[model samples]
Target chain A: MAITLTRTRRKKIHAIFVYLFLIVSSAATVLPLLWMISTSLKSGDIIFQIPPKWIPNDFHWENYYRAVTDIPFFLYLKNTVLITFFRVFAEVFMSAFVAYGFARFHFPGKNIWFLILLSTIMLPGEVTMIPVFLMFSELGWINTFKPLIVPAFFGGQAVFVFLLRQYFLTIPRELEEAALMDGASRFQIFYKIFLPLSKPALITIGIFSFQGSWNDLLGPLMYLNDSNKFTLQLGLAMFNGMTKVEWGPLMAASILVLLPTLIIFFAMQKYFVEGISVTGIKG
Target chain B: MKKLKKYEGFLFISPWILGFFIFTVFPISFAFYIGFTDWNSFTEPKFIGFDNYIHLFKDDNFLNSLKVTVVYAIFAIPLGIISSLTIAVIVNMKVKGIYFFRTALYLPAVVSGVSIALLWRWILDPDYGLINLILSYIGISGPNWLGDPSWVLPSYVMMAIWGAGGGMLTYLAGLQEISRSLYESAEIDGANGWVKFRHITLPMLTPVIFYNLVMGIIGAFRKFNDAYIIGGAGNQGQFYMVYLYENAFTYYKMGYATAMAWVLFLIILLLTLLVFKTSPLWVFYSGEVEGTKNKPNR
Candidate 1:
């Protein structure tokens, strides 16, 4: 009876321990973000106070207003939206088309082209930075959105193509075959059938592309010289350095810059999870 | 009918093919050609065979950048894999509110890189930072994480772990695919939990492990934004890519930078091939039939 009692108590202790660990780790994961919000609302002096306060006495709402008007925030926002929209559209459409070809066709050099595409996935964008920059420069595309948006249209992102191809392969061939027998053209079948079914994969690619282009500072910083052409990320960096690094405004701008990606992430959370699960199964 | 269908397929795929040729194939071939020549923005190309490659071997900053990159990859990849797997395993338990826990863990990954990095910069501020305050409770003085070269990579490692939600999600999916029947059988055989996990879970997870390893290595090699933002100009945190950027834009050493680019390409290619070569020994495909001459099932 004593042994049984001890065993039950030990199990209870272990359960409690596991719960404690989960809670602590989750808190640690979330604390930085919570603190960021808290600090952003605090006044400058209160932000750097020793023994940090959890909440501010006064909510400085003006910082957000200041973050916008201080820079050409509207211009930067417009550029980010424009570039991200085009980039995501191109990446999803082009990658889907290419992925379909890879999935369905048995043409000559198919394996080689597929290998080439995969190889490009391993090639670091940084390594290709200089030569690509020079190429864009030669084309007089510097200071424009061309360098950022054009390559995306070409299925430059091999990972997205690879992912879409994997998803497409899993789709039953009978669907395409049925469409074919109905006198439907390949394009019509792709548009009417494959695309509608691949909405999850497309959404996944769209979110990924949007997050990438929206937050990309390096590409815009590298290719665009004029401040007017700056994306939200580059604009945020400029905000950081404009004389006195105003923590409140900086944090506010950071949050604003982060909002779109966060909204998209939550909105399409299901598809994103599904897409990753599909990829993970193969991996 | 088949011949015309094939023609339709070709027409459907023409946009990608044309774009591939004009953008990818052309630029890639052009990049290689540029690497072999000394062409400034204004001047015509003067073929300077092997000069840029030779120069790269002697560059100290380039060598340091390589060392930093390797160090970062070594730390981040293994640590990220372990932490992510551990979280996935824990969350896979038949616990209440498991979905909430998963979402909470994954929230960081969805947060923008710039925001997270900025948050960390504040958190690791040495004096007034929350991390230091937490460490103070334990009577340990925390170093200036991002400012100090010794702690810079480790700080980034911490940041990487915070964003390990993506890998954790992948691992969770992999864990779910694991057969519950195997666990039941192991229990029936009087095998302990640890033994069952070691023999069953670990072996079954090898394919997912291999996938994460490849992705993590590639990602670590391409570490940019975090390091770039943290280190900035005049800081030793300038990663290999950052140095490549500086050379290309700051110093206008386009040819030299291009050569460095090729070297990076080779390194990544070799690493990928190495992973593939070793994958067959460990990566178990569920559909792979034994003792057959047929190609392994997709």
Candidate 2:
């Protein structure tokens, strides 16, 4: 009995240690973000004070106002929304359209085409960077939204197609056959049946596309030359430049830049986690 | 009717087929063509015949960028795998309120990249920054993180591991797939925790590790936003993409940039192929015969 008691006590101690370790690391993960928020609320003088304050005595909420005035926040916000909308729309609708063809049909060289699609998912953007840039430049599409938005119309991204294809495969074929028996066209069946059935998967890719285009900096930096056309990410970067320091407004702008994705992630947290797990397992 | 139905499939997929040709195949081949030329977006791309590639052999910035990128991959990939795996294992436990812990760790992953860099830049400030403040509490001074060349790569490594939680969900999914019977059997044999983890857990997780490893290489080579944001002091943090970006856009050396981009691609492809060639020896799945598991052709 005493020996069993000692083993239980040891196991209890082990559990306690595990919790301690987890809590500490979790604190480390979140402290910087918390500090960013804290700094955003502080006035300019206190930002450099020793032993930083987690909660400032006075929350200078005007820093957010200053952040906007420092750069054209709403203009950039409009640009970001425009880019994200078209990209996500293409990513959801076009990827689903193409994925339906792959998943439902058994055509010649289907397996080979599917393999080609898979390989493209693994292909990084660097390979096509320069030539694509040159293509846009030659077409005089640089400094316009066309370079960022047009290519997305065809297939959006290969990974989303792959995901939707996998999800579509799980849908029973009998449903489609029934639709066909009822004299539904292929496009009608696709639009009404497959797309509606895969709501969760569609939402998953929509969120992915939304998040990707929203936070993308390099694309806008490379393609968009006009300041009015800058995305929120590129605008947020303007807070700190070559010869100045503006920590408060910078942190405030960082918060603004972070808010959209944060809201999207938390609101659609379920789909986000599911998409990640599904991609991980399938990959 | 059958012929019409058969042709419908072709019509449905034609958009993607067209996209593949235009955005993918044409550009890759065009990049190859440009890599051998002296194109600068002004005059015609004069065919230079490997001169651009040969010039890169003597380019210091190219060599330094390659070295920085390789050094980063070496530290970031393995350390990232381990840190994320550790977080995954702990979160996989049956502890109470573990959901909160998972959320906290993953919050950074969802946060915007430039925002994260901005936040970290402040946190790592040598004076009056949160990290240095903590260091000073223990009577130690923190080095200037992005400002010092020697410390910049390590600072990036620290950032890489912080975002390691991004892969935690993947590892968690991988862990959930491990059979409970294996652990039960190991326990019956009087195997200790470390022994069971080493023998059973690590091997089972190798496939996920392999996936993350391949992704790690690709991501490390393509790392840009942070480097661009922080502006790696003394060129210490000038990753391949940053240098490539500057060459292509800033300097208008489109041909040289394309050559650099192709080299990066080849490096990634060769490394990936090398990993695949060796994966059969390590990555295992269930119900496999001896030495013939992943080797299909053999």
Candidate 3:
């Protein structure tokens, strides 16, 4: 009786410790973000105070107002939204299109071709990024969204194609063969059958694509020279550069820029967890 | 019919093939050529025949940046992976309110741009910055995070680890795949948590660890945006990619930049290959056990 009782008690203690560890680490994780929020709401004096006003007595909400009013917030938001929407649209659709080809077809050189596609992921963007920029420059596609958005239509990301291909391969050939028996074309099989069935994979791709393009800084920073064409990421960077050292409004704007990703993440948490596990990582 | 259908496959995958040519193949080949030239955007690339490659060794900035990147990766990779694994183990617990903990940790990873922006604001404020203020409360003063050359790499490492909770989910997926029966049997044998983790958990997680290690190395080597945005005290913050960016865009030294890029690519490839080569020794697969040759599945 004593041994059984102690063992159960030990289990209870273990549970409690687990909870404690979770609570402490979560706090550590949340602290930086909370600090950003706290500093954003603070007036300059409270912000500069050595002890730090974490929950500022003075709620200077005007920092948020100033952040929007002082900069081209709406313009930047629009530019980011447009570029992100198109990139995600093209990337998801085209990646799946190409993925279906690799998974279903047995064309001549298909193995070698797919191998080439996989090798592309091995080569870091830094290698080709310079040459790609030079190509765009020669084409006078600089200062536009062309450099950022166009290549996505051509299976721009090898990882996505690989991801979707893996998902497609899992589905039995018999599933698609039925549609083929009905005299449906290959495109029809992909569009009507494979795509609808692969909703989870497609949604995962969409979420990641949206996340990548929305948060992208380098692509926009490199290509878009015009202020009006600047994505929100570039705008935020510019806001920091232009302001020099204002933490209040900058933090506020940072919070604002972060909202979309946060919303998308919460809404589609399941797909995201699945996506990252499948892909290893975005880099 | 077989030949016709086989030819049709080309039509489906043509977009990428075309994209491969215009965006990838051409650029890669051109980049190789550009590495030997002296192009600066305004003029045609003049054949310099390995001058750029020779000059790379002479470029103090490139060497310094590479050293900084390698050093940053040394600290960031192990710490980042350990922290991520720790979080993954914690959150994998079937505790109540685990979802909330996972959400809290994972949310910051996706919040990329704003996090980068806020990292600067919170770290750079000498008196009011969160780090300094926290330090003062603890009876210690913080060094200037972005302004000090010595503190710059550490600052980036700190921020990268802060957002590493994003990696926990990948580890969770890996953990879930490990059959609970292994642990159940281990537990019945009177194995403790540490023993089960060391023997079963770590070995089972080798593939995921391998994946994360390779990806992490590549990422650390190419890490740019954060460093570029919060450029460290002086040029101390100039990472390899940042230096490459400056040479490529800012200076329009396309040839030199392309050469730097090819070198960076080789470094990444060689390192990745080295890890992969070493992986078989440490990375145990579930199916392939001791003294077996490399299996096709592996």
- Candidate by candidate, in order, the iRMS in Å equals 2.6, 1.8, 2.2
lDDT of 2 by residue, A91-209 (tens): 78999999989988888988898899999988988989888888898899988998889999887688888888878888999999999999999999999999888777787778778
Expressed between 0 and 1, the share of native interface contacts present in candidate 1 is 0.42
Which CAPRI quality tier does the interface of model 3 achieve? Answer: medium
Model 1 docking grade = medium
For each of the candidates, give the backbone clash count: 0, 0, 0
Per-model CA lDDT versus the true structure = 0.78, 0.85, 0.83
Model 2 chain B scores worst on lDDT over the 10 consecutive residues at: B289-298
Q: Top DockQ: which candidate number?
A: 2
Please state the error at residue A223 of candidate 1 in Å: 1.4
Model 1: per-residue lDDT, tens digit, A1-283?
9989997998787678767767776888888888788877878888888878878888988888877988888999999899998998898888888787778877656778788777666666655566577778878899999999988777536788788888888899898888889898767877798789988888877888888888887898798789999998888876765667677777887888898898999999888777776654332
Query: Model 3: per-residue lDDT, tens digit, A92-201?
Result: 99999999889888788999999999888777888778889888888999998888899999874788898889888878889777888989998999999888887777
lDDT (Cα) of model 1: 0.78
Q: What does DockQ give for each predicted structure?
A: 0.50, 0.67, 0.65
TM-score of every candidate relative to the true structure: 0.92, 0.96, 0.95
The number of clashing residue pairs in model 3 is 0
List candidate 1 stretches off by more than 4 Å: A1-11, A105-109, A173-182, A278-283, B1-4, B232-234, B280-282, B286-298
Full ranking by TM-score = 2, 3, 1
